[model samples]
Target: CTIGFGSKAKNIVNEDMVLAKVLRSQGAIPLVKGNLSLGCLSYHSSNIIWGEAKNPWNHDRSCGGSSGGDAGILAAGLAPFSIGGDLVGSLRVPGAFCGVIGYLPTPARNSVIGCLFPTETDTLNSE
Candidate 1:
């Protein structure tokens, strides 16, 4: 299991996130970090560190975002699974573009990662 660099914890050693811990307990190894969107809300995946994540199918196209790297890695068979967050289609968009399944767990269901968005705003939405 690997996490997206864009969402990694800002620690000296880059400590694992909750989801990573769970996966580790299950004997999964944390390998690498994938690239993700700017500020994780731009609906596109790219960064100064890792550069842009291009679509495996068509290099000219984007892999979609925030979770774009997650989908791309899976589509390319680079890993069994990559951790990512899906707020406002972050996961779905990339999954669709990469032709992989991107799932958004029910809010607070698994507590995988902290919401990057401000918590003052309610996350529930009918749209």
Candidate 2:
């Protein structure tokens, strides 16, 4: 149940988990994916794929896709925090490129119910 990167996770957003941290910290669930949409985020839903982050510093090039919006918002100081998914470098790539702190939790530690499914299985495997 993985929504491949690039144009797949293009514009899907869901309600933030009310108890994501509580559930995870208690081990009820390993991880949670929220807050980031390549085209939207908790702070905004601009449906902008190419517009992406303003680079916060660069203002040139894109912050990446699918989760690009989230990365940009976070990096640009729009919000102090955010959550996002990364199937093919959405989180890490833009994070590095935007010069922001992005954390791709340890394997089996986070559960991506939307973009990727079967939280019990790893979706990062290469085809």
Candidate 3:
């Protein structure tokens, strides 16, 4: 399988990301990785840093964001599963656009330690 992260936070995979560690422990192998916008704000993945991640269905269509790359990879059959974050439909929106399944856990259900960006602060609602 493959894994993708929101560009707003940790763009690269590291040991600090708990979900990556958990998935590795479960025997998942990292295959392909995709690109996203700089700060997870853009709908397209045409960032200068990593380039664009296009929709598998149609090159002209958007894959969605900030988890757009993740959904795109899954839709293209590059991976069976992917890990991504959401703070206002970041995960769900991409999944819908790509015609794949997406899931977001409740804030209390999972830990968000390493996934948080440096500028992030505790809020009344969790992203």
Candidate 4:
């Protein structure tokens, strides 16, 4: 049961991303460019990069931003596994709130992998 959320939610970032590779291999879909997403145009948010992500655990609490939609789906149990990018705490923040794994794969050192199998270890490892 996959679900998505946001005000101006675009499928490219969330829903489509989940199936992009498979769809591409099948030639059933076209490649779409990801948004630079320089910033959010929301006036209601003080953060200014789109409003804060709504915490399903407690709607008044923040989920995370930039990748809020991804977090929301995860928090709500919309999907078993999901993908989200991290320029900041976008991934970690939601994972903490939703009780799931969040990864930050680094491209250095011949591809740095992280959070793929997040454990209490991640919390202890962070410095």
- Specify the poorest-scoring 10-residue window by lDDT in model 4: 35-44
Whichever of 2 and 3 has more TM-score, that candidate is 3
What lDDT tens digits, residue by residue, belong to model 3 across residues 31-70?
Answer: 8656665567766665655667789999899888877888
**Greater-TM-score candidate between 1 and 4:** 1
Q: What is the lDDT of candidate 2?
A: 0.50
**Candidate 4 C-alpha lDDT tens digits along 8-121:** 344333234323455457865442211112242221112323434566787786555444555566667765555544545656655665566667654231211332223332
Model 2, residue 89: what's the lDDT? 64
Number of colliding residue pairs in each model = 0, 2, 0, 0
RMSD vs true structure, all candidates: 5.1, 7.9, 5.4, 10.3
Measured on C-alpha atoms, candidate 3 has an lDDT of 0.68
By lDDT, highest first, what's the ranking? 1, 3, 2, 4
Q: What is the full ranking by TM-score, best candidate first?
A: 1, 3, 2, 4
**TM-scores across all candidates?**
0.76, 0.51, 0.76, 0.45
What do the candidate models score in CA lDDT, each in turn? 0.70, 0.50, 0.68, 0.44
Residue 96, model 4: lDDT of 65
lDDT of 2 by residue, 16-118 (tens): 3433554557766433332334333222222433333455666666665445556677777766655555555656666776677777765656544433333
Better of 2 and 4 by lDDT: 2
**Candidate 2, residue 127: lDDT:** 21
lDDT minimum window of 10 residues, candidate 2: 41-50
Question: How far off is residue 6 in model 2, in Å?
Answer: 15
